[model samples]
Target: MSELLHLGALVPAAVGVGTLLAMRRDAGRADVLAAVLMLVGMTDAMTLSFVPPVVWFAALIAAGLALAAGRRFSPVATARPGTMVSTHLALGVISTAALILLMPAMPSSTPALVAPSHEHGAGSTMPQLVGAGLALSTVALAVVALRAERSWVHRLHHTTMAASTVAMCAIVAI
Candidate 1:
């Protein structure tokens, strides 16, 4: 489970960094897909069983930064095709990339989630079903994101992100 959390964290860092640094010029649909997945993965870190409160607070701060960058991203985000690439998108991608890289490397990291005294957290056997649901949602989003292109890609990513948000919400019930 610790390894899964580490891998989960790693996946976003790779995708977000790749989206910003490597794919900035081309703006491929895959790059957009990667960014979206990274964003979700970052938020999903909060759902892990063993993460501590301070780390959770750090995650909130990071989410605020991402939202700020998302706001900055509106220009390029709304620019007419053939006019310009999105500056806002670039900002969002880069800022989030920085965050994803910084988070897991911190000192005094969150404690490993202990097995719940009652029934709670990712350690709960029942919540694995919820994890399955969350996984399914991400998979669906990935499918839609990878399959779509251009304007449709953006739309699909939004829808997928929305679905991912809801599925993630279900995690709290665990």
Candidate 2:
């Protein structure tokens, strides 16, 4: 389960990195779609971590619905490319943050947050890994985007993807 979770995030990692390499000022809609799909795969990992599967599923459903509703209510009357990209990035980051904050607090981890079922030793190393991934992605993207000549919307994409990539990595790695 651990290995699968790690592998699953590989897609978003690749997409995030690849978008940067593409020099598009920001990623396209497909990137956002792909990243969220990768996030959904964490359902299995959540079960392995002994968290409630139904809750996670419901959360994912809520997120998907929210995204859809936002799209439906857009001023453009249809989802614009920029809106899609930003929405994906926002959802990805929010979901990742949720996972990171909730994991160690689980009933299974109570009284022994790091040692219960964490084969990786539930040590300080887990949070460190998560923090590093999140920090790197967001910081790099922010620096790159602000100095960029693109429009403000492009800047939003840059910040969103950067923050979300790091957040997702942080979440899944834990």
Candidate 3:
């Protein structure tokens, strides 16, 4: 079931990538890059357990920082009316990294009614809360993108990214 959910999450992200690439002449390089990064992050979430969690976390953090730096330093980013897309992508990457870092600390399963020993202790609650918060924030960003973006393609891409983020969170945090 979990695997199915993870794969389901990838669909929207793949759509977003396809949407961006299909309109490559209209989309900015930054936009395409952001969509690809989002796709990569979602893919990583699905296959995260294959390697050490720290490695994934570190890579995500570095990617996030690079995105941030690019947004901050790039003349094109500064010239744009709003840097919302770049900011959103950077936050998504960092949030994914944070969630991945917290995954090992989270309970593998929900506590059973008859098995109190299965209950997650207080230590696990923080990660859960953080994951929920990130998920909510991504949803909020999606709403904002729908309202703020002028282009239909951008709106679709942002919405898909948000859905992917929420799905990834559900897979890792739940």
State which candidate has the highest lDDT. 3
Which candidate has the highest TM-score of all? 3
Please identify which of the two predictions, 1 or 2, would achieve the higher lDDT against the true structure: 2
RMSD of each: 9.4, 11.9, 6.4
Residue lDDT tens for model 3, 5-113: 6776789879878866765444457656766765675565456344345666787788878877876776352233652666666777788777666653323433331
Superposition error at 71 for model 1 (Å): 5.3
Candidate 2 per-residue lDDT over residues 1-174, each given as its tens digit: 544544444454444544533435344344455444435535333334343433554555555555546554642333334433434444454445444443443333334323333435556575566556556756664665457535565454455455545544555455
Clashing pairs in 1: 50-113, 73-88, 76-86
TM-score computed on alpha carbons, candidate 1 = 0.38
lDDT at residue 163 of model 1 (Cα atoms): 43
Model 2, stretches more than 4 Å misplaced? 1-29, 38-116, 119-126, 165-174
TM-score of each: 0.38, 0.35, 0.74
Question: What C-alpha lDDT do the candidate models reach, one value each?
Answer: 0.41, 0.47, 0.67
lDDT of 1 by residue, 1-174 (tens): 434554444444444444344433335443355455445545544344244334444554455455445535543343345421233333333333333323332223444542222334656554445444544554554444444435543443334333433333333322
